[model samples]
Target: AAAVAGMRDNNAILSSRDWARRDVLMQTKCAPLPREEGRPAPRPLNLVQAATVASHAWPPQSTCETLGLTALCDTVRSVAVNREVIAAVSNKNIFHMLQLYVNGIKAAGIKNSMVVALDDETAAWLKVRDVANYVKVLRSRTGDTGNHATSGLKFKVLIDFLSVGCSV
Candidate 1:
């Protein structure tokens, strides 16, 4: 509430109709770039780092290794995550990697229903996305707060896949 009020008051005092520096996006890394003829030197926010949290899942854009996603990704207005060349990640700590990948994706708002197979050599990829965009279009309203605790879910995975899947 205070932040919103501050911006409103600021817009009035500063006679200029627009100020890029004070965009709310500044607080979150999601701020859009200013439209200017001259390019500003690249900063951390300017660069979209592929939020790769999976220690076992192949690094960013490894999902693009296939010809299909790779080709489709190019037609987009801009690219954020593209993991085409990377092979599926393999590690002794597969569960840790999965947790990090899941948490990191939560941080960036990425989601997907890629079913992972235990014996399959290829790893599935998930993409980060903005929930607000989808939420606005949704006519129904419900509490959307999500829980990130992995304490119980970890046990379930281990119990369900013990004999068939990776032990880690």
Candidate 2:
């Protein structure tokens, strides 16, 4: 009850529609007006300011380039199942996107038998397979008695210290 009263006191309970309308109005003011033909073109606005030029049609190519996706896309495309990371992405046309990823992976020389295809799950898992090899290396390092001062350190103070540091 007190929280509700405080919100009313501060006029903090604005509707999303009202907020969106206000944002659009603010952006419209920042846009440049038409000028005479003889004048030099206006200087480019910074990326944030450029967004105001077309509030309804923002998130343009420049925005994606600004975020370093141009370089990232090439590398991530080899491993990424879809346009984005598998765990955090969704698609309106999931079937089409999945087909694209599968085709891309297949074209990259991955065997069809190696790729897993399920109704709700599909992945090449090449990188994931490499990661499993890394896990094997890590396990070997921990068990390598030749390098360690003692044969077993599970009960040692150094192991406790390492575990504590890891938790932090």
The best candidate by TM-score is: 1
Q: Measured by TM-score, how close is model 1 to the native structure?
A: 0.23
Q: Write one digit per residue (lDDT tens) for candidate 1, span 121-168.
A: 212222222211100011112322122222223343333222111222
Tens digits of per-residue lDDT for model 2 on 1-168?
223212232225666664433443344432333554687887743332333434333333364365433322233333332122221121222546545654544444432112222112222233433310000111223544232322232223222212211110
Candidate 2 deviates by what RMSD?
19.9
Q: Which runs in model 1 stand beyond 4 Å of their true positions?
A: 1-32, 35-37, 40-92, 111-168
- Model 1 has a clash total of 11
- Give the whole-model CA lDDT for all candidates, comma-separated: 0.30, 0.30
Clash totals for all candidate models = 11, 0
Cα RMSD (Å) per model? 16.5, 19.9
Itemize residue pairs with steric clashes in candidate 2: none
lDDT of 2 at 12: 56
